[model samples]
Target: MFSSKSERLFTGMIAAALAVSAVTPVVSVEAKQSEKVTYQAKKQETIEILAPTSPLVFKQGEKLKGKDRILNVKIDGKVKKQPVRWSNLTTSTIGEFTATATYSHKGQTVTLDVPYTVEGYELAIMHTNDTHASLDNAPKRATAVNQLREENANRLLIDAGDVFSGSLYFNKFKGQADLTLMNYMQYDLMVPGNHEFDLGTEAGHPEFAEFIQNAEFPFVSSNVDYSGDQYLNALYSEDLTHKPVDGKLYEGVIKTIDGKKVGFFGLTTEDTANIASPGPIQFQHYIDEAEKAVKSFKQRGVDQIVAVSHLGFDDNPAVDNDLELAKRVEGIDVIIGGHSHSRLNEPVVVADGAEPTVIVQAYQYGDFLGTLDVVFDQNGKIVSHQGKLIDVKTYAADPTAVSLLAPFAQEIESIRNAEIGAEATAAFDNPRDAGDVTKPSVRKNETALGNLITDGMLDRAKQMDGEVVAAIQNAGGIRAPINAGPITTGEVLTTLPFGNTLAVMTLDGSELLSALERSVSVYPIESGGFLHMSGMKVEFDSSKPANSRIVKAQVLKDGQYVDVVPTETYKIATNYFAAKGGDNYLEFKKAYEEGRVNDLGIIDWEIMRDYLVKLQTVTPSVEGRILDVK
Candidate 1:
């Protein structure tokens, strides 16, 4: 559920009108044949009122309210454009009266029989977020949404983004085939996620551009500045605007449904600066931008504002979360959120004033479709809402997406089933602990597994004509703790599933010291702290905070341990993800900017697996060589 300013005003006007309606009454007016007299009065006491030049001119089931007229009415069901003749007015004063009104559609008019019962309309909002291209139905999520569409004719299908750059299928297809899947499903509107920029920001693929060009929907983002990037600028520049991320430019979109105007907009988290290759992309404050967008929508007279945001939900009760945004921002009626992959099985209702705003999100990877059923009363204020995470697993797969994805299914299944090797015991239980990397077997400095992987990368890099002087791997990317028993290829793949390529760079001993200092000074608990190196020994103090943890950094030169001096550069090997500085290693991102990084053109997992296979029988042991922590 998302909201814009017009929605708030519409809800407010409805509430005001409903409040004023209680004092009004419906009264019938009688006119003589010779003179036409209009009875326009305060009529404060009248509860039901009907007035016309002739009794036969009135119609049944048509809502009419003058300065002071209220009538008890009910609609039996929907009717086409036609004149409904009423035989009774049912006013306290007038016993019975005859009335009729003409209804028409597409220039055709007719008369229809009137019913005694009343009927109302229902609004359904259907959305999906974080769909990272689970393109095939073998996973069963892609087919589930297609099946759910059967329930509502006036339905909206929206993706909150992150629809690119994941899985072997996407890596193989480069998003051309992924867009085809969304095209076939007919998504009405979409926003791009960080991964959408993966193709070096090129819109040169005419086929890909043609698909988005032919979309029956719009791709909206208020944050991205594309003036520098021609590829993306040509494809989606027009829809771009300055909006907010953490606190900056928030823009909302306007859409009309069933003759009632509805508005929606989206925001992505600012964390992309670290998570993806953002490259000159700028982000703004999300809440501030949202506030401005709402104010703009209010000026336009469009109501029923919905905010489709990718800011992610805040689960920690201790954090002053975005649920605060709903209460803090006055006009927004609902928030449809994603990122952080949360599951909202029911709507989180936060009271505003007379009406409360609803927040909802389904878990990620097409496991569910979030359905929010909102009913706004005659005054435009939401009376009730029901949120549901429609389980995709429950529905049988739709054959079309399944059939389209069948060919690639076997490869994925094979990868998932492949066996790697046997383990004697689990390597370590606390893989997430930053301190785990400082311990004997799991410590990046001494862990047999870490040494094994870095050695592999060095071997691969050496094959590329680059002698590996240094090698480093972030412990966080090591997924499963290597078990002591059988380790299958499936386990290895799961541990290093991200398909990151290895990169080799030339760095001075001084620069290497800087890199080590940055890595050791930061105790990243479960992330960004553990450093596995092949040619360097880094010592850090545990008593020190992460930013200043490094005690001593040194490198081996011709088998001699030399203290790192400030100006020396050394050639090093690492993964492209780290070379790009993914793990708060802004120093690496800076290094790339300074022209100090080079790609070795080898996949990280391939090297590690090869290194493990060299030994027919492998047993990992801890030798406290890397860390001399005291």
Candidate 2:
């Protein structure tokens, strides 16, 4: 009876299984009758649609069809192929295009809008450098910036800094005027030049710190170490950030432009340590810092890099410059440079690395606005570029900027128009030999202006220290020209805008000789360290080597020139910048460190103004004070 029951139960179970199998296929067919239902069932809450990476390039006259319209649709990490149709997909023109791609399966559809270029992605950059606080043309620069920004959607405006000293505006407003205009123009980024630190030693960079605090844009400083400075340390960040805050400083920043990532970092010249009063702030090796920046950006998946560099275009190779930085380091795409006041009308291409790097600079003052249009492929490599300098004078002043500058201008006008009870018979031109090498440059050769400046410094120093025998001024400290007319306080302040204090140093004849050697080290090539003398005569041979170039050094004692004795001590007057070892004056630095230097606590412009008043009518001339025998 148990065996019979088991056989019956097994037969019944087989019949039930066969009945279910027959209905299962029919039910499956019915469920898949609508393809939309099947797709929805496979669709996940999270879907990733992968398209070709941007900077997508298409050849001229190419059609957007076939495999180009395909996308990888990923659901739950499983990818499947899907065909897409594009709207407004025209490739006949060579420019950027925005288009939408639609994917449809049965009754289900999804869409995505993307931007691509026909040939390559075009990026427009507007840059300025070494503005030197010449805010008179700020309105015109604003006009140019506004027009350029309006012309292109992909654009950036940047500055390679020195917006501190040079004019009455900086003397009175202390960079606030420039900052106001820079804010109006909407600058993207900036790097500090040497002159930005001019007030560090005297005022501890109070105005500069305020300038940074009030700026509406961010500052990048990859090689400059602000940690040593109490004021700047609080505002500086060593990390690379994707989201940068205005009125702050960073080592590096990542910017997103049209779904592409671009990296920017700042590099101030290392010469700042010797040339400017950075106080306790320090500078690092540019190459090392630059390499680290590039690597950090690369690790963050940023390929396009720009360096807002205060290093000169082709300055002293022994120190640091943009050209050297580009060659020594890799992965730098563009360099917007300043310092040395290079006017690069066209972009300079350096192709020493795997990819080419482009360098550009606007000349000193607010005269020109540099513009560069660079094209990049999908790989973020610069393939083609065009660069040019737009004369800011050509553009009419922006009315908005003008209105913003009105109050500052009114105050500056009153101060600049005040007469100093002096007149010049001839225009005291401050010439530079950058374009014409044969011409005499105030930086490379002696000038009447230099003489007058040093004479004033000597007069002031002698009043304080009777034993002061001579005075000297660095060529870089001499800024603008004096017109042939009534001398105004503005002109004097503009010419000597650094606010340097008069200093007297007791140095032996040998030490003075060493300072002279350092001054003429780069003889014919204009050097900021070049010395302009008063109460002294120096004759050097240009053909001879730098250290031993001085043939004869004489000091005026009681209206007579006497040969300098190597062991004899002589009291010299010069600006505190020079006495403190500025412009690489190591011997003077040693004297200062040894307490042989006394700062007179008087402003340089004040000395010049007072001396001008002393001489009501002056006719200063270059009188063979400095001669090159070669």
Best-matching candidate per TM-score:
2
Task: State residue 292's C-alpha deviation in candidate 1, in Å.
Answer: 2.7
Candidate 2 segments whose C-alpha is farther than 4 A from its true place:
1-117, 202-204, 419-450, 454-487, 491-630
Name the candidate that leads on lDDT. 2
Residue 42's lDDT within candidate 2 is 31
**Local accuracy of candidate 2 as per-residue lDDT tens digits, 171-220:** 88889999999998889899988878878963267778999999999999
Candidate 1, residues 351-455, lDDT tens digits: the string is 964568888887666668888887654334566678788777776766676666666666667755565443435453323333564443332344667766776
Cα error, residue 310 of model 1, in Å, equals 1.1
Per-model TM against the reference = 0.52, 0.61
